[model samples]
Target: MEAPVYTALAERWQDQAGLARLAERAERRLREHPHGDLTRWRDALSRLPPVEPSADLDRPDPRLGATAPDLQGLGETLMDLHPWRKGPLVLGGIRIDTEWRSDWKWERVTPYIDLGGARVLDIGCGNGYFGLRMLGAGAELVVGVDPTLLFVMQYLVCRHFGGDLPNYVLPLGIEDLPEGLGGWDAVFSMGVLYHRRNPMRHLRRLRRLLKTGGTLVLETLVLPISRPGDLLVPDGRYARMRNVWAIPGTDRLLGWVNEAGFENARLVDMRPTTTSEQRSTPWMTFESLEQALEPGDGSRTIEGLPAPVRAVIVATA
Candidate 1:
């Protein structure tokens, strides 16, 4: 059977040019991927008893509970999909503490963009957490793209509880999207630019995905330097993350954005990541930000690089 998430998205976006093809390609890729745990995840998701989701997107808790009858059952089913990375999701009164304080990121982002009735695309959206928040902020539709199957499953669980809202997270990457298929009013590329091997290509692609005068909300790890050309090309990894290719300074980031054909790019916010914002919890038991930091200095990463400091830049496409 086709996943209800995909079916609903296909039906709703069928008339939108190029959306149907993208959805079809995403479905095909999902089927071909060898995800051995998909069946178990699906079973766990099916066990979640239906309840009217009470989404409090404006608050720190983006909850999905409302006097649920089977709180214990809901918690148990949610735990079956462990290592929750991007949430502090409250389901049936149980707080599934995630690895990252995605709420902090949301708080930093939501203030700058006008989501009202905007067609938004979230690149590398993990579990559709921010997408849900965008919907709550009055976005017309939110399309999140990420290649990870586990995150897709996690999103499915939220979708099931959140009801048939106009938000969809596809198991595909930014590269999977066709170029010049512009319609989105706002494009968000958070925690994703550093992971791209070619940051310029990624930026240009984001520009192509948006309509003229569209907003691009970009948040990524940045080096704490004042120079325009200074960028840290990690020899191997940055903060224990292997895929991080480049960490640019604020000026360098702006330069890149302007060079990528974006206009009026300006850094809006920059803050060092805190242990309080990200730490190991009962729901996410894996090594976290606290563990990733250097034991002696606490400011530098375990690899002796400058600690993770993120910057949010708003640009015009």
Candidate 2:
């Protein structure tokens, strides 16, 4: 049986042939990358009580539904999906304090763009948190793509209470997107650029997915460099993440955005990531920002590299 996400996509995104095929491909991809604990996760999802709660996505912690009868049991079931990274969601009266205070990042980006009735594409969207925020900001539709199956399941947990909103999170990577698929009003690639080995190619791909004059919101780690074209190709692991391949200076990032066919690319926000923004919580008990930084000095990573300073760049495609 097809998931509700695919069913919703078949109806809401029926006008787009590419999205239709994408829905099919996404199912196949999930089948290929099946997780061992998927059954357990599904069982927990099945255990959720039938309650269609009202959602308030505009708040710092997106509030969903009121306090239910079996609040303690509900919280335990939700705990089955551990390590919640992107949110501090209030679901069915239980507060899920996630690893990252994603609200701060959202606040930084919201003032720069207008999502009123816009069609959005969010690359590397973890459990559709920003997608919900986009809907709250008046977006018509939000299609989020991420490779992590765990995040997809987390999104399902949210959907259990939030109902079938327009915010859909597909378990697919940016590379899995159909080539030449354009016409998005806005495209957001947050905390994803540095992970790509080829940053320029990734930026170009984001450009190809946007309509002419569409908005591109790119957020990624950066180094403090003097030159416009300078970037750091980390020799080894940076911030305990092996997949991070490139860390560009803000100027170099803007230069690459302009080179990749985006017009008027400019940096809008820049701030060093702090422990307060990303720390170990009950929902996400794993090592966090504090562990990644140097023991005595938070100014540098454990590997002696400069600490993570993320920059948000906005451009016209």
Candidate 3:
């Protein structure tokens, strides 16, 4: 069956000429690249009983629930798609304890952006959790882009419960977006820059996607140095994450953002990740922050690299 989420998305963006091709391309991609467990996920999605879409974005638990009596069944269906990473969502009576305390990230970021009636994009958005929060914060539209099919499925499940809001997660990446597609009021690139082989190129792409004087909220893993040019290029992996390419210092990160033509680039928040913020839970039954760290020291990763410290920077494009 065709996903209802796409239908809602098409209707929402039908009036915007700039988004026509994007919407079409997204639809084609969704149709062409069905995940191996797409049918199973879809079936699981269908089993979820209808509920009112009421999101509490300010709370630690972003909830969508009703007084439904079949919450046990709903939880079971949600469990079918496991390894939930970016949420602590409360649906019905079930609280999905995810791997990452994404709410903490949200708390760090929400204060910096003026989301009221803004058009926003979240790069590497996992499961559209933050996208939903954007909508809850009064954003006119929130379009999240991620290449992972599993995350897309999880987003669709959230969309099903959220009742056709103006939020969509396209199964694409920053590279998949057309160049010079500028119009968004704010562009967010959280937990994405370090993974890119060329972080400057990623920043430039992000700048290209925003309008004149638009804001860019960038959050990424960084080295703990206080200098401007220092950077750590991991030998193989950082904290068991294989794709991590470069961990730049805050000053170096600001330099890259400024070089990318972003103005007023400044670091807003910087802090190391903690076990309380990211640990294995029942919903995500795999190695987590606790397991990824060194056995004797919490400050370093298992690979003996400097432990994960993330920084959030805001700039004008």
Candidate 4:
């Protein structure tokens, strides 16, 4: 896939010396990590017909332009990049019903955070779906970081149709970002905290990424507990996700946030994930929420862990 332009840094990050270095580091990482499927994804992106990019981002599906004349060919090319995880994007008259009805999650998050003219960092941002929504909600620039090459390629596809807006998905993980560059207006860590072995360190790093009084919007799997500091360290995989390390109670997470030096940490929204919100679709035919949970019992995973009940927490740095 072609490297996305990192010009968004020029707008606000020009004053931060490290952000220029960050742009260079991101470029180097993209150049060095030559994913084996890069050529295939590039070909898929190339197949899209050239058209003026037009988008309506303030919608559930985030419509992009109109139907291509060769709709079947357009759909086929998009299908070449499969396993779409984080969107229900509509582009070129094709509605990609992704594995996750991410719009539903966005709806829950939108009311809690204000992105107006803010620079944001979205960790584990899959396909830049939320980044697009952030821009639609008035964010000036959204610098998304995700290590998954497939997700990065998927973002390039979105950019192809959505035009080169301020939404950028860099093929770099949160750890790849340079230290001491803390001036983000808002930082988001969604569906990422549980995967970290050192949750406190993760929280601290998130704090460091934001400027003073910057907002941190965090969403992650949470379990209810009778007392603060209670945590669930799954002996093995929870809900078939191997990388999930810990699921904390909302109170425990808030405590961690406070200990990380964030102020006014509070839970904004909490809800159980349902099959309707995340399920197998034509665009992502692999097993999803349905297969991950125990048969007939929706409240628990097949492994008998509490089913994925996510919580959104907001705090100020």
**Better candidate by lDDT, 1 or 2:** 2
Order of quality (lDDT): 2, 4, 1, 3
- The model with the greatest lDDT is 2
Output the lDDT of residue 254, model 3.
92
Give candidate 4's error at residue 112 in angstroms.
1.5
In model 2, which runs have C-alpha deviations exceeding 4 angstroms? 1-3, 225-229
Worst 10 residues of 4 by lDDT: 1-10
Return the lDDT, model 4, position 286.
Answer: 91
Across residues 1-317, which tens digit of lDDT does each residue of candidate 3 receive?
48534545545545555565666677778778857887887788778787776555556777765645787787788889887999888766678899999989999998988899898988999898998788878898888889987898888777666666677888888888876457789999999998999998999899888988999999999987643357999899889999999998888889999999999988999998999999999999898898889997988899988888999999999
* Winner by lDDT between candidate 3 and candidate 1: 1
- Cα lDDT listed for each candidate: 0.85, 0.88, 0.83, 0.87
Best-matching candidate per TM-score: 2
Better of 2 and 4 by lDDT: 2
After aligning candidate 3 to the native by TM-score, how far in Å is the CA of 243 from where it should be?
Answer: 0.7
* TM-score on alpha carbons, each prediction: 0.94, 0.96, 0.94, 0.95
Candidate 2 residue 69 C-alpha distance from true site, Å: 1.6
Q: By TM-score, highest first, what's the ranking? A: 2, 4, 1, 3
Q: How close is each model in CA RMSD to the real structure?
A: 1.9, 1.7, 2.0, 1.9
Checking candidate 1 for backbone clashes, the offending pairs are none
**Candidate 2 lDDT, 141-192, residue by residue in tens:** 9999998999998988788788778888899999999984678999999999
Question: Candidate 1 lDDT (Cα, whole model)?
Answer: 0.85
Q: Local error of candidate 1 at 317, Å?
A: 1.1
